[model samples]
Target: MLARASAATTALTDPGDRLAELCARIAGRIVFTTSFGIEDQAISHFIMSRDLGIEIVTLDTGRLFPSTYTVWDETEQKYGRRIRAATPEAAALSALVADIGINGFYHSKDARLACCHVRKVEPLARALGGAAAWITGLRADQSGERAAVALESWDEERALIKFAPLFDWTRAEVAAFCAAEGVPVNSLHAEGFLSIGCQPCTRAVAPGEPERAGRWWWEDQGSAECGLHVGPDGRLVRDQPE
Candidate 1:
């Protein structure tokens, strides 16, 4: 399944064509997780505009910026489709805050990962449950850690096929596509917040920094990820198990 999907995805040049092919080839629910970033907005436009049956969802980490929510609302309004939100379990979130305080993620890497687990990763698991294919807007040039991302691969941990239709696209290409399509995006992108995540952990990047440098900026460059795409070894999971 992985090899055939990879071959099919690689054969396609356009992202929209790849997506349409995936929809035709895959049997069950295809889930697309968006964060309202430019890449995500572009993918959302493709899926919604084409009326593709892919289920669009988002991880509402509860700590998102106002601008993020504003863009979220605008995207829904523009597409006339409600992007399903997978939120953190209230009990787990309450316990986490009680144990480590509200902003404890700033203290240690372990603390931050724990916060991310409770907020983003866990909710994502619930969102991807029963999905045959999981789609993301990830691109190769977004960060060094994600440089080896594949267009399609098997997610062994989640037991689903992972597809990054825009895996080979560049930031400039994505921005240009969004501009031409008039896809609604977060307003913070113009203010240098190239990669917007949860409010407390994200900031605007400097002129020469990588696109994802604004996310988890205080952490080591190698550890900027929030565990959504990584394995237990802290590496991006692109395994194709035999």
Candidate 2:
């Protein structure tokens, strides 16, 4: 496990200090992005509990769930961390709408990806350009592609350190942490929302479905994305962008 971790990351190897130590060293200039989900809440809970100095930011895509927004505000007030929001670039969005037609993302694969690029990816790049490290709430159990990702990685496109504090945890363990700590989470998870994205792009998964089925359910094979995690240069980073 240690050898695998080292090969997978450029971060420090002290397993005992993997999450907290990294946050302490980097949090001053680092920022954690959240969607107010369980895994995200768990990491935020750790930061709040440890009194780490890091900015907590969220991308207000303007089309998020009411509960997601609610939790964002509530979590800020509860934890006393200022939750900064990055909004969509209006000019880019206008151009996207013009080129793709209104709601064109729903009509075809290209259209959906195009919409995601303008709305999520570009805005996130602007947000992270000045930060030294960006934190996320990813778990290996989330995807087979993510199974080998380490707790911290060198993000090539963003050219910064990327940390996933809960990368080693399982879904149940994450939920248990949230429950144990009494953290605020999105209410939609109880209804089988294994993975949640924009309201228009998300749905509740049924029995035996893949955890990510809630996102981009319409597309067939090779067509899953909402663009925030993809770099402007079109390479996929380890975690969801927003």
Candidate 3:
């Protein structure tokens, strides 16, 4: 089933057309998760403008920058539709917070991943429940670990097909599309923030660093991810790019 979907989109050159066709192929069971970053905003624009019927969902980590919320609000107004919100369960989040103070993630990688599990991954799992496919704004050039990203692959953890429509898209392409389409992007992007996540965990990247360098910046260079799109074996499944 997943192979058939990938094959259907293989020949498409345009991202908007690729996404529209994928949404139609999967119909009501597709979910697109956005974080209001440039890439996400571009995908959101395509989905809304085409009225593709794919549900747009966002995981509010509760630690996002104020600018991110500004983009989100503006996006809602522009599209005249609410993006579905998914969040961590209260009790679970409280327990994790209590065990390791709210800022404990700064102390260790384990603490950070635990925090991510509570604040991002758990909520995402709930958001993706019963969906046939999940979409993300991931790009191969973002980080070394993500260098081999596939436009389509099966997600073992989520038990569904994972689609990265922008896997082959460059940062320049994303910036151009957002600018041309008037997409509402996080204002922080102007400050050298190529990638945006929680305010506390992310920072502006140095000129020579990877796009994902800003995320989890304090950690070791290669350990920047939050485990959302990573497979159980710690690598993204690679397939031929569309």
Candidate 4:
């Protein structure tokens, strides 16, 4: 059933024709954000393979793991295209650190989410300010909330046509895709870091916990979503109402 569904949704099921067709249609205005995860790398490969004119970008978050940066550099070298960096809000790290010191987020959920907003959500909003469409590597297997996502949809939240090219893909399929494509993937994945974030907040996932369990592990896992998801108005909301 899953195979049939994947085949039905995979634009490249034919490998030679449909892939290019999809790429041509969505190229240029489309933008992809990479977090150096296996699923992300797979989409990056698929996009680059077609030489789609869509630009690639990522949020640096300023607190990413060394492994993530390495993958970023490797992907840039292999693709020969600039992956623009989106940085956090003005003096975000400095202000947050000054107010409560660097380790403040550990104290409370509100504090932690504030840090994510300043360091990731704000910068990401600026990065995607003018995009017509945004692509992500989100997969159903990653989280419970993402279980019903689709391959493509108009993200009323982001106010852009959001594309989850691998929404239905599983861990095995993502790994296999990377192996076949030889894409540059994060090394942390090999060390049990199924889902990684900033070094301070992230840890290696244990036996069968959800992949994203490592992110903001201290807070309610449900609150783990960063600021760039949705707002009351359903547009891509960057800042929390103050």
Worst 10 residues of 1 by lDDT: 1-10
Q: What is the clash count for each candidate, in the order shown?
A: 0, 1, 0, 2
Report the number of the highest-TM-score candidate: 1
Q: After superposition, how far is residue 236 of candidate 4 from its true place, in Å?
A: 12
Candidate 1 runs further than 4 Å off: 1-3
Candidates 2 and 4, the one with greater TM-score: 2
* Global Cα lDDT for candidate 3: 0.86
**Best-to-worst TM-score order:** 1, 3, 2, 4
Cα-based RMSD of candidate 2: 4.6
The numbered model that scores best in lDDT is: 1
Cand. 1 Cα-lDDT: 0.89
lDDT of each: 0.89, 0.72, 0.86, 0.71
Q: Please write out the lDDT profile of model 1 over residues 130-199, one tens digit for every residue.
A: 9989999888888888888888878888988988989999999999999998898899999999988999
Worst 10-residue stretch by lDDT in candidate 2? Answer: 1-10
Which residue runs does candidate 3 get wrong by more than 4 Å? 1-3, 6-8, 239-242
Query: Distance from true position, residue 125, model 4, in Å?
Result: 1.0
Off by over 4 Å in 4: 1-23, 26-28, 233-242
Per the 3 Å backbone cut-off, how many clashing residue pairs does candidate 3 have?
0
TM-score of each: 0.97, 0.85, 0.95, 0.84
Model 2 Cα lDDT, one tens digit per residue, 1-242: 10122332335443225555665455336778887888888778877767776677777777788988888887888987777888788998889889988778789888888787777777787778788787788776776546665576667677677777777778888887688878988889998887877888899989987777677888873435465544555544664222
Q: What does the lDDT read for residue 40 in candidate 4?
A: 76
